[model samples]
Target: MSEIALEARNLYKVFGRNPAQAVKRLKAGETRDDVLDVGTAAVIDASFAVQRGEIFVIMGLSGSGKSTIIRMLNGLHDITDGEVTIGGDPITGIPRGRLREIRRDRVSMVFQHFALLPHRTVADNVAYPLELRGVAKADRRARAEEILAMVGLAGWGDKLPSELSGGMQQRVGIARALAADTDILLMDEAFSALDPLIRREMQEQLVELQAKLQKTIVFITHDLNEAMFLGDRIAVMRDGRIVQIGTPEDILTDPANDYVEQFVQDVDRARVLTAGNVMERPRPYVPDTGGPRAALRQMKDAYSSAAYVTDRDRKLMGIVTDRDAVKLVRKGENSLRSILKPVPQSVSQDETLMNLFVPAVESPLPLAVTDEHDRLVGVIPRVTLLAALGPGPNATEEITLPMPPLPHAEIDAALGGAESAHEASANEVPTIKAPANEGEVR
Candidate 1:
């Protein structure tokens, strides 16, 4: 596990002049409403760790105390009770001066509004954080220019915030926070002000940046879809408390409570589901040198008619089918290379299921799930892929009739004879139809 970059230990924040009395009541098992009877209880016993370089999202509807929790993390909101630590230093009740130093050096926040300076040039706005720390003007300017380029605002830095679009202004806000060179980012609805299309664009950019920058981000959002897309793990808040914390798949497939279940019931599974979710442990394969006889025997044992062929390093070479194996054995061929046909379809583990539709439909072979090195990891059979998208308002329930059975009879038995005659043709492992001219899928 990654080292904890930020931790909230029983963190509590009550928002009122007599907050201490409310905290005491809350500690003694009085509810948030009861605490509110005395004074506002904005957060109650919220605790979670933000691991280094992970996007930890806190999400809930309005008034869920998510924003309050983030404020307490950066010491912007006074903690009523419990502790918060940043980079291993206890932050609750720290001296104001020390708290300021931690906020300056270890953490930065991006607010919902762009918060850009209307009159300042983008470069100046981005450099403002560095300027506060007494960085040399030239050094800060250079840093600002570099970060602007990273955010895709390269030559436009000389323009003022008023001259930029909403998305661009948000980028400036992000650039300013990044200029502080902090390890933690507390972004509270930072992209909420943008147009829907632009908000999505900003989200994609943040995802891309996270791939390169690896900063520890605490993203607060009310949109469940946004939370599912951006968060490595999510904390769902309600009534000043966290109700669930889990990965997107975990939250979707196994909701912790009815509230969470209702919250995610409408989520687009295809958008959130990846090839990794549907892929099965690939059946055993043979090296290209494994003769036709051995290949045939293995296929029979596995009740499969086709087998993947790979090199010594497990790099995919091609696929060999029962028909080809039979012909090769008849011809007394020692190696399976002559009969091997190039893999018809493949997907990276992270490819969203939405992107796999065309390939899944067009290919006869199971979709190959390959790693970055083009080495096969597992396979997503058409049956399994269809099953994942089975009967739902958002899914094509009609897919049941067209889905071919899995390659093995054992699987057919397990599936209660969902296997059909159409699937038997999989024995030939139909080759991907190429343009009459080009030879490869790429």
Candidate 2:
């Protein structure tokens, strides 16, 4: 077994008039007129390699060739040019029987629909693939039961697919794929057909399964949100070309172009950009008894625009700006301490950058992040955040912070939860807003 699970080189898939003409043109040079005159290329010179135990996602709008490239991966659709290597062997030009050997032995695909055997029980549907591959009935059934429990469907093995809800049936389909025990699993928009809440649940379930199984997966989707949530590394496709491929943190904070930026702008960055990504440079020294005035100078020296203030222990205290320091000095105040503003708010290190508004408005001047100990460990100034998440001036939305961790009772008051039970802070694990159009948004 090679360390590399899959590799593709300069793959192209074209359709329409003079398909040969397009293939010939690819050999010489790509011409827009020839492609348009013939047919648009589905995947134009697309290439990448997936190492073992990697979850590689390809996301694009509808008709962006995510599905097409996936089909090519499974040999369901032939590529016009280029080679696809699986397990260190090029399977792109393999014969039908050889391809079947690879599909049955090394790869299995799970479609958006459950594609279950409607007439058979869940156990039978899951075991059918094994049966086709010549596995004995007893072994197939035993494997099916084991996979059933793996996906949380242990006792319902005898139930028909129709008896289960869409999400449950999808779980059955996933269990079936797992029963194959292949080197790679290909998922084609596997969550699209479900309700938003169900889809989100399924996405989380996929993550949990991947953690345990560690199977190399190629997941296809047109939803950027899903790509961000599920992929270990993502490939953003447009008009059949991969625009960018990287970790979700990079895609959210440093998109490649305007198209990528537009998709990121609407996303709640606080929820996507984690605290760890933006904590690049820490201030060199913590201010002594000089108050925030000395701290403001340090802040200005670090970035000249907006800097942070921390306590003697280098824990975030508040922000001291030159303007604030000057005001305190003009008032004949002996110390710049009174001029310092508390952090707008505090946020968990795991939160996405889009959800940053929650803490920004809550904090005073410099944004502080600390563990439950009430010690300031990190700070995010407004300037840094704007440069990270690009959008309209919505970055100005701020929330003030306190010295230490606030109690639940205080948090309830801050959220106005006691005044009206309708609106409260979002749960850390995410509360699924029932299926879309259920009644109201969560």
Candidate 3:
């Protein structure tokens, strides 16, 4: 396991003078609604661990206790019960002064609003955290300038926050957080206030920044798409409790319950589902030494019209159809190499399912799913792609990729009246093979 950067253990938050009574009631089989009748339960039994350098997202709808949980992590709000540990040391009930020190030196928060000092210059605002820590002016200024440049605000240090756009101001907020050089960043709806386009830009930039900074980030959001795009692992909260925690694909393909299913119902499956998810185990194939009779038998046994040819090391040679195999045997050809045809189409296993629509529709044969080494991993046939998309918002989009003349009949036949293929099926196809390593489907 990776080193734990932050850990919340059975955390609870009750809003009232008599929180102890509420906690007692909660422990004694009281539902969240029951506690709500007494006072408020912002969070209950919320526990999760964030690995070092991971972007752990806590996401839910309004009043789900996501923001409350983040506040407790940095001691911004008192923890009514339970413990929070940072870097293996318990800080749940640490002294206020010590907690303040840690918050200043080790943790930084980026709010949804760009909390910049209106009177101060951009550099001053970015350097605020370092200033609070008594960092030397020159060093802090240097760091602030560096962070500003990193966030695409280079040479804008002298400007006021009022002079910059909303996106630019948010960049300054991010720069302020980075200026502290904290091991952990607490971001509560950090991009929520920006416009849709700006929000996407900020999300992309944050992803890029995380790659370079490698800071442990605890990000809160109500947006599932944003959570899926940014989080390494996500915890979905509901009614003051985490309903589910899993990777994006995990939550998308296997929702925990009805609630999670509804939560992800409208997600753009095309964006989240990769080639690996849609690819089927290809039918059995043989090395170049296989004769026409042998090749023909393999295809017949696999219920396939064609078979992929590979070397002993699983390096793909080409494809050979049953018709070619029959013709080769009639001509007394012993080896399968001379009859093999070029691959119709191919894509890497990591390619997005969205990107494969054109290729899958255009290819007469299944699109070969290859690895970085160009070794055949699996295949995605037209019917399989159409089956993967089914009939939904993810499937009816106009093709964007340039392609050869499409087979309209084949396209119509695959998707004309099929059931929803949004969910993956375990059926095998032609060209699938066992991968030599991880990430490829078995």
Compared with the true structure, the alpha-carbon lDDT of candidate 2 equals 0.72
**Predicted candidate 3 versus true structure: per-residue lDDT over 222-300, tens digit per residue:** 9999998888899999999998999888888889999999999888777777788877665446667666655665565
Ranking by TM-score: 1, 3, 2
In model 2, the runs with Cα more than 4 Å from the true position are 31-33, 36-40, 283-378, 381-442
TM-scores of all candidate predictions against the true structure: 0.85, 0.70, 0.83
- Segments in model 1 whose C-alpha atoms lie over 4 Å from true places: 284-290, 297-305, 393-442
Deviation (Å) of 135 in candidate 3? 3.4
Q: Candidate 2 lDDT, tens digit per residue, 1-442?
A: 5388998788888888666678777668775455678777888878988889989999989978889999888788888889899988988877899999999999989999878889999999999889888999999999999999988899998899999999999999999999888989999999999999999999999999999999999999988778888888899888778888888878986799999988766765555666556643344223435543344434334433333555555555665555555555456564545665654566655556677755655544444555456554455555556655654575455323233222444333333343322221211112222221122100
Error of 1 at 228 (Å): 1.3
What total of clashing residue pairs does each candidate reach? 0, 36, 1
- Overall local distance difference test of candidate 1: 0.81
Report lDDT (CA) for all predictions: 0.81, 0.72, 0.81
